[model samples]
Target: MSEERDTAPSGAAAPPGAAPEIALPERVDVFDTTLRDGSQFEGISLSVDDKLRIAEQLDYLGVAWIEGGFPQANPKDAEFFRRAAAGELKLDTSRLVAFGSTRKPGGVTDSDATLTTLLDAGTETLCIVGKGSAWQVRKTLNTTLDEGRAMTSDSVRYLKAAGRRVFFDVEHCFDGYKEDPDFTLSVIEAAALAGADCVVLCDTKGGSLPHEVQAITAEIAHRFDGLQLGIHTQDDTGCAVANAVAAVLSGATQVQGTINGYGERTGNADLITVIPNLTLKLGVGTLPEGRLERLGPVSRHVAELVNLPLDPAAPYVGTSAFAHKGGLHTSALRRAGTAAYEHVDPALVGNHSRVLVSDLGGRTGMSMKAEELGVDLDAGEAATLNDTLKGLEADGWVFEAADASLELLMASAAGWEQPYFRTEAYRVSGYHRADPNQPGQGAHLSTEATVKVWVGDERIAAVGEGNGPVNALDAALRTALGRHYPHLERIHLTDFKVRVLDGGAATGAVTRVLIDSTDGDETWTTIGVSPNVIEASWMALVDSLVFGLKRFEG
Candidate 1:
């Protein structure tokens, strides 16, 4: 195991008579189980390619272990390891770990199919999830507690004998500890005596509170003075991150979690949140120097690969992690920087501070947002625009989530004009066609759009088709503009969101649309609002094009 005695920063000496400092370990291993545990989430389904991509990202983030997948469970996972062994996927800083259960009760360790599959998976590290709860032993496994302990021992011993480093995950450990402390300790003792490199306490039920986790982990740490301890927690009670941190404080040297908290039920402890908390808040170390800033990109990249929408409110790497909206908060931020409203410097995690404009914000927020977008506006103009924004928001226009649209509004007030083209007219239609091959077949629906715009006295017309009205409109608009400005080719609509202004009005209510666009290098958001969904989408789409042209084409 790697070890370094923590010391004060260079050139700083301890004061005379100061108490001897408790030495902190320089590194805490981060074991990411996103591919194994995270894929168990109801909506999550990662292809082999997706899993490989995420594993690479985790390595880039400098996690200590990438729990690739369960090799014995599925063909996809088995194929992933096969490819990994064939050198299709390579990791620089992280060790690939193969996860599987311990040998079956009353089974021979060498003959266990799952154990053999794990060895064949070609990972230097092996993680065995053994039965830890005595109740589970009798009730679920239908076996005696001694057999459970023997399963744990034989598996660890056999794997260790094969020259593979083994980590024993004591599944349902916290509950087992609560019910029978001696039995739980005996299970851990079995793994340790069998030469396991690490023993991870798994809060499988995810119901343990932080205090309970700390006390149990403390006792385990005290009892096993020389064994490396790890923690794995689920978030059913919304305390996974807290419990993981508590376990670390009580002497855990490794953390096991999924990125973005992706897992079954409520998810596991989010390593994205755990990394910063361990290193920045608790003054311990994980990952490597200067890799913390990749947290945002890594989190978002995994979400993108898994086809999961990134949660904007996720802690640390979330979009709103460092955003300020209220006028009071903006005012304080403008005067005192982010420290006035945010707990940490956002840039520390590759995220930037964002000042949002909304009904809750006044002129101060407008000025702050305008300054951020590099729009030149006097105080009087800012105040006027702030009032204008409030009136628009009252009319169901939301600017907080659509910074690009807000910028366009402010710039238009400051005498900016659309340089590319002026929208003359546009129309969208949806139709259905019967399948010709099958009798009485259901109609296949499709959307088409026609757009016309005038650029320097020349009118451009285009038609496009897509799976949806908004997509068809976007395609038509881009077709019209792409001929005149080739730069339009770089802009792609990444995300579109729609929300009804008032649920009481139901179908007749106005809708608010937020469109996110990116030009390969940068992303911006625009908003539109109207009673008509098509009109709302059109407004946001046009604003997105204009913003992209202004920012990137210029």
Candidate 2:
């Protein structure tokens, strides 16, 4: 797709602590911060070059602002700001921006050195923090209530007077509003009085309930006629996105969130979910039309840039966001457009409705799903197969979590064709460290796996070992089959979650392992379940290979 089409606003100014309640279809600003706040994830690390590349992609997707990074965090951050200073990062519809805290205690308000540095970075906008939480003031600043207000007003006024466009993040404003409504309102009043452009209420600890968020945001909109109010939520309680959306529904317009919910703790609100939730669901405005369809891809791109695995269950952007399982759900989707299994048209988010068939599929549902997938199925056969699927479920095969594999089983059972390879025999063995390291290294555990496969007249063998038995088996299976298919170059094990369906005595526990893989452009999930983890891994492994073959062969 072409990257250039339109230009985002050169500037948008709002009175502090008010609502920017502009009305328009297909236009709401997505202020992305996957770099600044997203990089705060426990294991996530993005480089200067990585941020630039992601910024370019976000621009192509038509975000309003991409928070480039925290310029003062470390040498790496400072280096990115310095490089970004060249203005080389250009977006047709997105502006590169940076974030930083307001002046620290004892720091001069006018011409503070860090403010100078943030402005000099040449980022189009600056998001700065101002103290709004009473707890933060009393515990961190050791200041009385009046001193905290001075610190906030002085910071905003100084930043605005310095001629740098400023967006004020009222750190922990929601919590403060709950504990000390009067004091929180005072902070907003002060910021608005100081000419700050925007006042963003932040859930620094990410624990606000949705009803509370809606109430507070509504109160702010009603009280602040001359200021612009926004919401920034973290996801400690898994309600950050919900809270942010409720805030908008209650009257707040501007919303601040990371593209993929990256931040300290559980993470910030996920814009990936919020954009469509606001536009298509809540009837609110959003930035750049149609890029909303690219939410899933854009999310995956950011995760990939940060060397992170894509979550299959991530709402709106995960692999399973629009996936339909169970006979009833698939039958409904087949009968109606997203009525049976979904709340929104997945196509609006650049994803197609996925119908997965397995145990629990009814004849009607299987017929509908199969017809939608262009599979040739007779009613009688479909009914019989549905029964068969139910039987398999009774035996403990989880088809919902592994649709790719389930589809292959359906196709094969329906006499589609022969598989390219079949398991003739396989062996996975356990191992332990024979000798404890006495020199420089410590003792370690070991495991081994060997597999043999048959393809008509040819037979191949492969072997591997790992710290875990399942990993070793997966390695061996892939190795045995990889030589014949160069496309298997980068299939990986993204996640392995085990669910004990019949939890009880040792003999009664049935285990299921879910495997997610990617072949570059798209992602797929496979499932395997059995009494043994090694056997479960093999089932999923077989499904992964065969399902990928079907996709490419088509």
Off by over 4 Å in 1: 1-24, 428-439, 444-452, 459-472, 475-482
Which lDDT value does model 2 have at 25? 30
Q: What local lDDT does model 1 show for residue 483?
A: 79
Model 1 weakest lDDT span, ten residues long:
1-10
Note the Cα lDDT for every prediction shown: 0.90, 0.75
> Mind giving the per-residue lDDT tens digits that candidate 2 earns over 325-436?
6666665555455644566666678766666666655676677566655567787778877888788888777676766766776676677974577787778777545454
RMSD of each: 5.2, 7.1
**What is residue 540's positional error in candidate 2, in angstroms?**
4.3
Q: Give residue 343's error in model 2 in angstroms.
A: 2.3
Q: What would you estimate as the lDDT of candidate 2?
A: 0.75
